[model samples]
Target: MRNPEKKTEIRIVLTSDGSSSVFNPEFNQHYHSVFGALQESQRIFLELGLYAAFERFEQINVFEMGFGTGLNALLTLLEAEKNQRTVTYTAVETHPLSMEQARELNFDTLLNCHYLKPLHEAPWNRPVSITPVFDLVKYEGRLQDFQTTNRYNLVYFDAFAPEAQPELWTQEIFEQLAAMMQQGGLLTTYCSKSSVKWNLRAAGFLVEKHRGPAHKRDVLRAIRL
Candidate 1:
């Protein structure tokens, strides 16, 4: 597994919507869109991915490609609590933030939600229940090396931009992910690149281009076939 601490430096940066995101110096990437981190995550991952999945399944198994800053997981946990929906969320990340780094983010302050600390502090490689309806399991390692027997109903493909991490956006990776999803399962990502769309198609997903949040023009949502 890649040691992000040795090769990368992270800094907190404010987005347009008053949320903070991590900026990775090695990849020249921010964890979320610069236009608005909260907005982007809410619209794409939560609204388009999780909520949509909940409409089709009573119990949801969500797999996240990147768990940077824990914004997406925290938001999902809040949503699950509000609706009393059962959610089993599993996320894989090569570089998890230190407790101090997680505390520096302003998501809890901005969202007025107090679960960020618990979400970040949850133990790795084990299931932990932050709330009655929400369970989380975080894996600290590379996506390519991660293994899971759980078939996910929803996926938040929140990796860095393709320009930064081309390997993660390829057909092989999508094929591997496709094998782990159930039929009609949903996968959403912030990127709308043609290569990404094509790769998803090649991996046996029915792809659609959706209106993105904030400054992004388009995002991709795919269903497993």
Candidate 2:
């Protein structure tokens, strides 16, 4: 289920304790909050999927499903910096976070153990180039409405769980995403549900399960064959 209350600023939903249910706390902050979900997303999607994919792709393009709060984008910047890789980050966010709140999240701490006060302070929707390391460009839209003109090296399919957002897991969306991937491009998601796996295959991917991050058992890693 979706979050009951929408947070206009940070674009976060309050998650229930150990449940996927997102709700706004009476005091604010979603059920899962910022630090917990974003950190886990980085460890699983970027550290494992995006980073690994970049090793083989010289000019990497990343399409993220949810730009919720720009956490994944921030992590991608740091990862690109450390790996010294060229990345063009294209992210979709129907709900973009506010600059003031994003600044409050202190993303600078995530930048190479050093304080990148500039990145932390960069306003949302502003594409910033950290150079051969990172070039972030954001498109503000719903994931379902995205249409790509170029093939991407990797797709961080980091949307909400299929149970939560079934529309995102449909074969139609997968087919569109498949059209945007170069041969051998990979789509990584934190979900390993059987239906999700089947849908991806229906869209023409070679889907397989992989080790997930903390608290999760398995994740799906799909490659264009």
Per-candidate local distance difference test? 0.91, 0.67
Output the worst ten-in-a-row residue range by lDDT, candidate 1: 1-10
lDDT of 2 by residue, 1-225 (tens): 223244463333322222121233332434233335555666677766787787778888888887655556666777777777778887776654444445454344434344334444444455777555777666666777776686897998877666567888999899989999999998988778888999999999999787766677788889887
Point out where model 1 deviates above 4 Å: 1-8
Model 2 pairs whose backbones collide: 14-23, 14-30, 14-31, 15-31, 15-32
Q: Name the best candidate (by lDDT).
A: 1
Per-residue error for 160 in candidate 2, Å, reads: 1.6
Displacement of the residue 19 alpha carbon in candidate 1, Å: 0.5
- Model 1 C-alpha lDDT per residue in residues 62-92, reported as the tens digit of each score: 9999989999999999889889999999999
Give TM-scores for every candidate, taking all chains together and pairing residue i with residue i. Answer: 0.96, 0.78
lDDT of 1: 0.91
